[model samples]
Target: MEADLEHYLEPGVGLLQDNASGCAWKNAAGKKISCAARETEALVSDLMVDQPLLWLLVSFSVGILLGKRLFRGN
Candidate 1:
């Protein structure tokens, strides 16, 4: 039974062994963080690329706010 289990899990065992020295937990965490960062960056870039008008509106609103504050002395 044990031998059969080992045989069945041979590929998994080999994969674990291969990653043992590198520490799979740290590698997995790093990969996840890297993937999340890449996805976030891609999403932001896509938004900028697809919605220039939206960005323009945001910048215009900010400019208005700043202008109001700066010219409020009058």
Candidate 2:
């Protein structure tokens, strides 16, 4: 019985060994765990939120530029 179980499990064992080096596992929701992009986005968002005037000016300028480009094709 034990030998039969080991034999049956050998393929799974080999697959796990082959994929052991990298991030081959998923979370409970089937998503690969990662934080670098999230961290950078959060940091930039926080900076934007903290600088209200700068954020507003930047957004206004971008909006104007986009509007002009769309309307005037320039």
RMSD of each: 8.2, 6.2
By how many angstroms RMSD does model 1 differ from the true structure?
Answer: 8.2
lDDT string, candidate 2, 1-74, tens digits:
65666766756686766578554344432442356667788989998889889888999999999988889943
Leading candidate by TM-score: 1
Off by over 4 Å in 1: 1-21
Tens digits of lDDT, candidate 1, 8-35: 6757786776568788688999999999
TM-score per candidate: 0.55, 0.46
Q: Give candidate 1's error at residue 22 in angstroms.
A: 2.4
Worst 10 residues of 2 by lDDT: 24-33
Specify the highest-lDDT model's number. Answer: 1
lDDT of each: 0.89, 0.73
